[model samples]
Target: MADDAQGATTPVLPPERRTAGQEHVPGNVLVSIGALLLGMLLAALDQTIVSTALPTIVSDLGGLEHLSWVVTAYMLAATAATPLWGKLGDQYGRKRLFQAAIVIFLIGSALCGLAQNMPELIGFRALQGLGGGGLMVLSMAIVGDLVPPRDRGRYQGLFGAVFGATSVLGPLLGGLFTEHLSWRWVFYINLPVGAVALVVIATVLRLPPKRTRHVIDYLGTFLIASVATCLVLVASLGGTTWDWGSPQIIGLAVLGAVLTVVFVMVERRAAEPVLPLKLFRIRTFTLSAVISFIVGFAMFGAMTFLPTFLQVVHGISPTMSGVHMLPMVIGLLLASTASGQIVSRTGRWKVFPIAGTGVTALGLLLLAHLDEHSSTTEMSGFFFVFGLGLGLVMQVLVLIVQNAVGYEDLGVATSGATFFRSIGASFGVAVFGSVFSNRLADQLTDAFRGVRLPSGVSADSLAADPRGIQSLPSSLRPDVLHAYASAITDVFLYAAPVAVVGFVLAWFLREDRLRASVTTPDVTETLASNPVERTSYDEVCRALSVLGSREGRREIYRTITERAGYDLRPATSWLLLRIKRYGSVEPAVLAERGPVPLTVIIEAARQVEERHLATRAGLDLSLTPQGEEVAERLSRAREDSLAQLLGDWWGPDRPTDLVQLVKELNGELCGSEREQPYDGGPAQRFA
Candidate 1:
């Protein structure tokens, strides 16, 4: 009796919490998503908004030497803090932690706008990055919590759209603010939008306390943060601030390597590790991380030189260059949105990253052939293909990792994937910067060979100020422009092979069917329900949808019969369980509940009665004493079959909620038509 009571209580969650983000509270979903997107936009915008404002900032602050740190500090802090924030959200609660991130970001943003010098600006930006990291990862984790994998595509796609939008808009907005207002407005602009998002989230995004003992992994945090900071500094500073072989660069590299080794050891021993090493064992998790990293490496690495190419070779203004980037932006938005809808509807996704990487390589190869004579239209076309490839790879890769893990690992898993991509982006920028700078210098030296009469002008001066290339003598200007174009082509040539590596890695991705619910689809309804309202009954119907086709029914039958070690048709077992449920119900009533035909019901009854498993008088049906024992065993058998099918929950024992979820999911097998496979086979791949 005590055990039974404990079982009953286990299903009841502390108190039902409702939020717009939770599926159960569906009304507030749009508002909640809007708020989440607002936060995402702020983080993404910050990464780019400072780009066009940098010159103005440098002039005002008089710190040209420390210019790169403006961006590097943010990236370094954001990358290091990502995993830690995720782990904390898992322990303390995502809602409060997310809100805290917003506040921190706001504080940093406000301070950034007020900074009088480069050091203060970099410090405030780092502070902002701490919060920005949390905002990004937590928003994604929240989506995973709210939406099932199958339905997540559209939301993730929207996020991709936001990212793409910000990429183009950030520079334009930054330039406008710097020219028309103050350079500081670039940071200050986040204030009103962030305040609105904060208010919306606080009001609409409620979640139950999922707190536990906060065994903060202080050592792991310190080690990983040190490693991230050191690596980012090396990437941002090497070959520019210091030579690649300089002691400063070498020291940072050695420090990063040692810190990484210590981080791994610390994680192995830490309770509630920041990034669980066990996740690496999952093929999807590990593979997705690699693919994400490579995508970032190739994409960010090569794309860094695009604006310079346009300004020097094509003579486009900064604003015009931003405008000319439209082709890539349009392609990305279309590909991401379309692919998401297709995946949500069809549930087949493995083909995307494979094809995306292939296209990315193709795009880079074509770009390697670009020269001084390349038309703007031709350049736009290449960018479109590259953008499409990135679009297809980015959102879906996260979905794959999220689908592979259990619920408890969602936050860490999402954050870890983002972290790898960020690290890749940092390294890509550095490596590509070094390659492009060296090649450009070599090309200019050759172009300027044996030339004279350009008084007070040098190759280095033209390289720094691309605008000055046009202002030089027409005879010399063409040589400089051609040299700039040739060097950029070499950068693309170098980046193409990296993308091919991603293509090869994508082939190993194991395609698993996306799950229909945030948690596994089970029949157990954890919450108390009104049988009359039939919410549980609806869930059962949804689960039955999985078994609507002949293939699904066959799998279930095969599973059950294999356990029985004999051909035990579902009719007999189902009838016995039904009899137990209704307590001697009329035959018509039993048939109605099962939606069983009269003839099939009669046949099952006769077979059970013959075996002394059930008996019937007139229209009424009852389980015989022997039938009760047989039914109990069959029920346990059903549970075992379900456990095998649904995948295991993450605890010592399966929760009663899962039992209820599975039971609720087993709604009467409505004869719904099986959905046919989508005939459009990887159209997004071609885009």
Candidate 2:
């Protein structure tokens, strides 16, 4: 289900549930998971690590006009490549593809570190984004291959934590490296970490070979990529590198429009469209996409410039700039976490995006008021308000989309939401860059009109090297700083209207009853760590697993026993299910598998034997003939109970794959010794 190119309409089991030639032991699974996490960290960190370093990088590399491309190139490549990687992994095996992605990322990272010019760094960053896309998609998909659906929730939080940690750490680390070490170390840092992951994956990761037929949608993918590229080029280069009406910019705009039409036409006929055009017909999805784009535009665009504002306008070190950005990060984290929790508890969600966008606009307006004399406290307050607004909206967009679509469109809708946000991010940076460059050029020219007497100190040089301002004549320094402050603040001033549009659109979103599967806060999806390339069945399983975990471990067996209509003790039912799954269970082996004491295991074994549900022979318990019948009934009951959690999804016409998934999950859930019930508690202890 996780590997399914389409949604649950298809009939592929999730990777971990597939029949394995050799089972992965716990230790091996742990080590493999570590490697995958490291890979994910590498991809996630790169998203933010370069922000604080961008000013220094531009100073050293000398193309201030092209600064946004460094971030834009990576985002564009990653967004375009994400779906392709998931589909390719589905067609071929994932292990080799995962390894290949790591190698490509490392190679790109190395080249990025070695880049001597802005163009070279931008090119290398795109190469890294190509691999980074795979790392983001496949790492999450691979988790499905390593752990059973019943246990997946336990690890999902870890992936979310990785993204959360990187969001804070990336900027700080980038600042430290740039201020203390060379800025080149920002790219070079991926080497040792990626190498460890590469080695660990090669040595420890193993999976059974599996393949499926898929229409790759190569044409649709290409058209979309081309369209994005042209549009971004137009945005980033227009009015800065070239006039907006120049032949080159006009050509790109026309080409982008044509490609977009072609993309829509192609998607109409493609066996599996890169992004299904049919999704637009769903009003909720369409509105969510628009709002998501706006949110990305405001959030990432603001983030890109804040560090520059701090370093240039405030005359702060890169490291201090990173530290100063913490208020926004904290506000974002707090608001997202709280909003998610509130939605999960109340099932109400429409208010968040509206409030978020409103606050975002207010924050942007406040930011526009910042000048060279703005206090740190005032700047931090504005940043916090902006982040708070973003946090309120970011996590809910995906959840609402998931609830809005039917089972058939689940996977595509989720990915589609993420895709638009990424595209918006790319556009945001480029548009912001275009605006900043044009404004800065004009402002710098005006400020230095007749006062410049230094031989080499011109407006162009000041724009290229912000660090050179320290050496400027005292009389000229204030004007230069004010020019930078206004240019950056004007970016936020212009962006506030975009946020207002989002606020208006947010009102149009018809709130739907949240699905039980979506109500549980999936930190991975909410945090945007895992690209949810999963079917409806897979998505449900992950959510239910997390829900079940939250319901308390000891109580799960009891609930299952009651739901199965069993009068037997929870421990007896668990033992019978275990024996039914494995054909035979030894008390000692059962004890070794979990924290359940030998005495509890023996007691459960004795209870089953007394009930004639099992027969003991040579310290191993096997089901009796009557026991077999009861066990089969119990298994069906367990599967039915699991199915009941799916709500309307468990209809009479449900797919065979879903039925199979439920049965597989039932076996795994019951087989987990760690979750075994201790009905009598400490009183039953033999020791």
Candidate 3:
């Protein structure tokens, strides 16, 4: 039954039991979660799997010069599409859009497998990225629809595991296909997995349709897309395809700045903005976005060069380089899983971000000290520290952002956090790529300054082909290896300060408490429709909290009377409501448990009878038919008002949780079983 403001009819089910989606059944949850994980796996695995096959792709397509574009195309497209997909899902239904993403992804995958050249492959990968962005953003949005906020940590951690597992598996599978089968299999593999995901979502997942009329913000979309595209190109192509100081890069940079100003202006005025400017007003949301961007910048920037160091300086094969990166992956998985359980059990999260980012800074500092002779154990430990820090920080930021906003803005908030991270990654890769190239060129030139070279061979030739260093005189190998090591170390040295900035930002994050329930879009809309009733409910919570038992009982009566237009006094209304909520009660029992005196209880009962609100049958008192209707109206009004006021602090069952908290507090006040103090220490600072 729907909650009515008039309180004319009351559903037998309590407010806590009702939510936007279907009732939480074990079978249904498993089915829905399973489908979502499959979709996530498909998206994450693609990012890494192609890395191992890039050399083979370059060889087959004869585009040795255009190799970076293969990855750049995908990253740019995904980054640009993320916000649009998120806003669209909020406006329309997510299921159809989600399914459409899968279909588009599968089509891109199939076409990519059939590509005959580098241009075709790059074009197809861009298409795949467009779909891949939706798969990621929509999957998170759908999970918000399926799970409540307090329990979302466990699921987010599991998704982190999917990313971790694919990080390890992607390169191995990519290598195997490139060596034994074919490089095309990297793209072909997604086709089958995506199909399975499609089937699962179609059969098992159910979501409510969008009923509200949406004003699509087409102008905002154009401006935001333009900003994202220009900024990403400036990052991706600058210092590589075009000089950083050249007209092409300069023009893109200027264009990006101009579009950003325009986008912000448009969002402030749009009725339904793609990314609401108001969200930045929330302290946690803004702080988390900043921290996420910094982490992405340092993490991805450092990661891009690790394999190069292993290959050129440490002399490891492509497959072994992947294996060598396992410490970070293992550390990420363990920390992510453990932190998730702790947050769910304790409901404290501030410490994770604070400590995690500090650890990240320390890890990067240690990595900056590495040289050609650094031990394997030392390198592994540094990688592990960085990964552990990431695991703790990344998932929690998403969780914090989701909880800060109402259901109406949940998708936009999640996407905004993701968008910043992606942009940071792009910037880190481009800036560091330039640094590595320049530093290596300088070091290689210096290393070969006085050395005699083979006829027609330059230092650049030996730098490009490491195998040529083997053919060089034994005396020169050390110098060349030292140059490669120093250049790579320079990359991490640059990243360490960036990670330190992230650590500093973590202190500013406001530790807002996580809510127990995911606020569904419907609840937000309901409150929006009755803004005045929402204010009344907020007043009821404050008034109820401080009032004595008798006063609190009377306030409850007053709240119901005001909403329902009833004229009953506290005693009569309270007596009537007691019967309605708790069913038939004997007069002796009512007197024993009464907040007022026994005389007051007896007098209230008599008044209720005189008003024909209830009747006496033997020792048991019950509401009459007319009394039942009045009681139902009172109950509905009370519930609706309270729900609007305290929804943020509520769990899946707002009424149930609220009642339980009150009872527990009352018991403690009376010196019953004392609740254990939370041992979170500094972590509990927010509370």
TM-scores of all candidate predictions against the true structure: 0.67, 0.89, 0.67
The digit string of per-residue lDDT tens for model 1 on 366-434 reads: 889888898888999998988788767765776566678775565467556666776676666656666
For model 2, residues 1-687, the per-residue Cα lDDT tens digits are 011011111112223434563254335577988999999999999988999999999989999889889989998888888888988998898889999999999999999999999999999999999999899889988887777666676676678899889888888999999999999999999999999999999888986666767999999999999998998899999998889899999999999999999999999999999899889999999999999888888888888999999988997888889998888888888898998889888989999989989998999999999998999899899889988998999888988998888766777888888788888888999999999998999999999887745778889999988878988888889999999999999999999999999999999999988877675445555545224466566676677766644543445556666776767776777678767765677787667544567787788888888888899777678899988887777777767777776677678887786777777666665555243322222232111
Q: Itemize residue pairs with steric clashes in candidate 3.
A: 7-633, 148-518
RMSD of each: 11.6, 5.8, 12.2
Candidate 2 lDDT score at position 684? 23
Show model 3 residue runs off by greater than 4 Å: 1-36, 51-72, 87-96, 111-122, 140-161, 178-183, 198-213, 339-350, 399-411, 452-477, 510-687
Clashes of each: 18, 2, 2
* TM-score of structure candidate 2: 0.89
The better candidate by TM-score, 1 or 2, is 2
Cα lDDT computed for each candidate against the true fold = 0.65, 0.81, 0.65
What stretches of model 2 exceed 4 Å from their correct place? 1-27, 450-452, 519-532, 535-537, 552-563, 566-631, 672-687
* Predicted candidate 3 versus true structure: per-residue lDDT over 304-419, tens digit per residue: 66766765688766566667777876776567656655765576888888887888788777777878898888889988998888777765766677668765565567657766
TM-score of 3: 0.67
> In terms of TM-score, how similar is model 1 to the real structure?
0.67
User: Cα lDDT for residue 446, model 2?
Assistant: 94
